[model samples]
Target chain A: MTTIGENATIYREQHRVTYYECDQTGRATLATLINIAVLASEDQSDALGLTTAHVQSYGVGWVVTQYAIDVTRMPRQDETVTIAVRGSAYNPYFAFREFWIQDEQGEQLAYITSIWVLMSQEKRKIVKIIPALVTPYHSEAVKRIPRLPRPIHFEADTQTISKPYRVRFFDIDPNRHVNNAHYFDWLLDTLPAAFLLQHDLQHVDVRYENEVQYGHTVTAQVNQLPVAEDGTVTTSHVIQVGEEKCCEVTIRWQPTTQPQA
Target chain B: MTTIGENATIYREQHRVTYYECDQTGRATLATLINIAVLASEDQSDALGLTTAHVQSYGVGWVVTQYAIDVTRMPRQDETVTIAVRGSAYNPYFAFREFWIQDEQGEQLAYITSIWVLMSQEKRKIVKIIPALVTPYHSEAVKRIPRLPRPIHFEADTQTISKPYRVRFFDIDPNRHVNNAHYFDWLLDTLPAAFLLQHDLQHVDVRYENEVQYGHTVTAQVNQLPVAEDGTVTTSHVIQVGEEKCCEVTIRWQPTTQPQA
Candidate 1:
């Protein structure tokens, strides 16, 4: 049993700097950042005395539902970054978690927050987060968790894709919804790598609107995030593209999630 | 919006099962079983009009936390199976989902359930699940999820692996957990494909225990799983055939993740 405090300032931490995680600029892609979130989450779960069996004993398993992230920076090839992650709060049936990304210089780079749920394995239904399981970590949380807004998907008025993109066989995962990380590829593919590196994500939330089946394409688009009151930086996404309605989204800038330290 | 009707059931839904999801028996794997679940969920999410972006807006992303399944049955290559999935429940922060898999002929194969959590994007922390977000899915749910006991991970830990497993550039995923589906290759590498298809996975949960470096050997042992559960199956793996533990794993057979129709 390893304790995160021994490695991270706040909790258990993991560091990685794989070459494949970067582009020409050596910066990590948003998709790669997504991967970081996963690696970190798995690390944190192992630390919390939560075993696969312990989680399964309840007749349910955890699955990522959605994510909203703010990436201030991206790591480049061979550049190691520290992923500091911790658990936040939950009702009785969920496991809400948080993640922080920093460079070797300890420069803050990205922040991620996500939602998860428990489902019945046999009946294949959603179940609640059992308190007895989460109580231990709820008390050990580092700080307060903020509430995030639900995304407004435009599936009703969304454009129908005519040209189905040739989906790669490798994109599929154990759960098969095009590995969530691949979303970065479709997203960043719309723009030049240089543009992606120069601009970090301030805030982003993309609710999964539909499935992009193999040999079937989903329209991709980008548009600005709805403007905020203080006239703060705005958000934008490649509003609509592709034929299937899979859009490339980008937000102006909102320093939410991971803060600059 | 689309919804999974409770009382209304589809006796046998024909599915065009893909090929990449198979094991030595030429069938889908338990790890890939999750991918199958994802496909059905995406279809269901779309039926509900919830796009990926829409889910992201909530600042919470859903990710798998736990899972329990008996491989008493699994679908063979090209065998079509019916998928029934629905929203179970979500309290403040987590959403529970369920899935049922059967053969085209309507035979039970495996039952699985999982839990997910919601978190904040800006603060990178867990947050409450707002009913407004989960209200869309109208289905019966449970407060507690069932859990499965994980088998004991090998204890003779050693990390001197140097055999050199090439980094299949293709094997890497966006969030990079060594694509769970690829583990089969490593496991079956030493044996003939004929020898591998003889049994099924009753249950499996590997910790990844450690990362297999970009150019290192990933020795494995296949002793534990098929034993007393049968006891005839046995295999041992170490960094070097005679070495201690660099990586250790056990596998058992019951039926298969893909059940016959």
Candidate 2:
């Protein structure tokens, strides 16, 4: 496979898709793809001296705030794939990172842009971006970092499909919080199985507003937008714990029927 | 680390645990531990000539029937560990395998014994084990293979806690059945969080009797026996889809508090 980068700006890691990581289609699921990115980023952290060991020593860590993912295709199980991540930019409040996946042939399959913030472990409060943390990674300091597209607003009175979702202990990560990827499971699974089987997910954009803890039961609410003339579809989702909105996601899809066969 | 084996009889794979594989305690969870063994066994299959490609070509695959796990310590996240698996024996209907996990310093952390059966992909029926499939691994055949200890039966009239668990899409493995490891989550999560937090799991023995498909809503039934004088506790669990018992598990736990500081 061609190298993702030949310089210090980009970090890349190769992963072989395992059976347990794939879905019924024999392809990696959205959560699995996001996990690959997370793994690669962790590798980069280790390489750049911001290893978990180093960061935890200071009683601080990074937490993801939002993510926007775009997909062209899904890799099948056992396919060796590469994930490349780059620190895009950072300000006093937020840092931006970009992640992309490539097939064994070095063809791009999917990409994700995520927003994160450094937080104090003890207080669980956001902290300023320390100059030392950013300097070691050698990331460019842009005047303005790009943000995910604004979610389209649906009619305020529209009814939504809702399902009860309970957070299980296994969903809790080492960070003592629910892993962000699991939000996708609650969001997507809320849709009808027939809808999922009849359409292919094309894009996803999500914003995490609150952290969900173990033993918390939340309601997953979904609303489908009007279908376009070309048969494309969009859906809006929200996960709420009582009256608190924990997260929000918007997804786009295309019909599964082959074109001009 | 010391070598696991120098011959084909034992298959070994080394892994550095990632952040998501760990729990709040920074240690691997029961499901993650089982997943590591499954991954190593898949590697062995690939190395010993029964790769997924080869197995799929014959329209048959191996399915676990039962597992008995003994744990002395749990590896923390980022720790490098090795999983070694050995094919013990096989008859016309069953195959026995053994798995063990070791730390980087070569200390044994956990061990597991599992039973498996080959099932045809189309008919979903058990198939005869061909000698060619087992000969490449060169395992020793024995007169008889011991089974996991039977779970202590709970009184039918006794009150038990039951939780509704709906199988999510991601829980389904590539084989179209619920992954064996996920049963641990459903079984353990049914317990009260306070009980889980106050105790450390000691041992687990489980038998897989029926397959749970995606979207199947099953009731997780848990029965806790009275704590013994020495602070040992045993719990019996059964996962039932309607009236059919899907699986059974018995777990032992010890209070986290020490007798004396």
Error of 2 at A182 (Å): 0.6
Per-residue lDDT for A45-106 in model 2, tens only? 88888887688787888888888888887777889899999876777888888898999899
- Candidate 2 structure quality by residue, lDDT tens digits, B238-258: 998998888888998988642
- Candidate 2 segments whose C-alpha is farther than 4 A from its true place: A1-8, A51-60, A120-127, A154-159, A226-231, A255-261, B1-8, B51-60, B120-127, B139-143, B156-159, B228-231, B255-261
Assess each model's interface with DockQ, reporting 2 decimals per model. 0.02, 0.60
Model 2, docking class: medium
Model 1: per-residue Cα lDDT over B1-261, one tens digit each: 123334222222235443334443456755456656655765566566665457777765554544445454777655778777766665555566666788877777766555555555567566776565556666434454333334355543343222223333234443233443344445434443334445565554332223343323455444333355544453333332234343343445543334432
Fnat scores for every prediction: 0.00, 0.69
Poorest 10 consecutive residues by lDDT, candidate 1 chain B: B160-169
Best by lDDT: 2
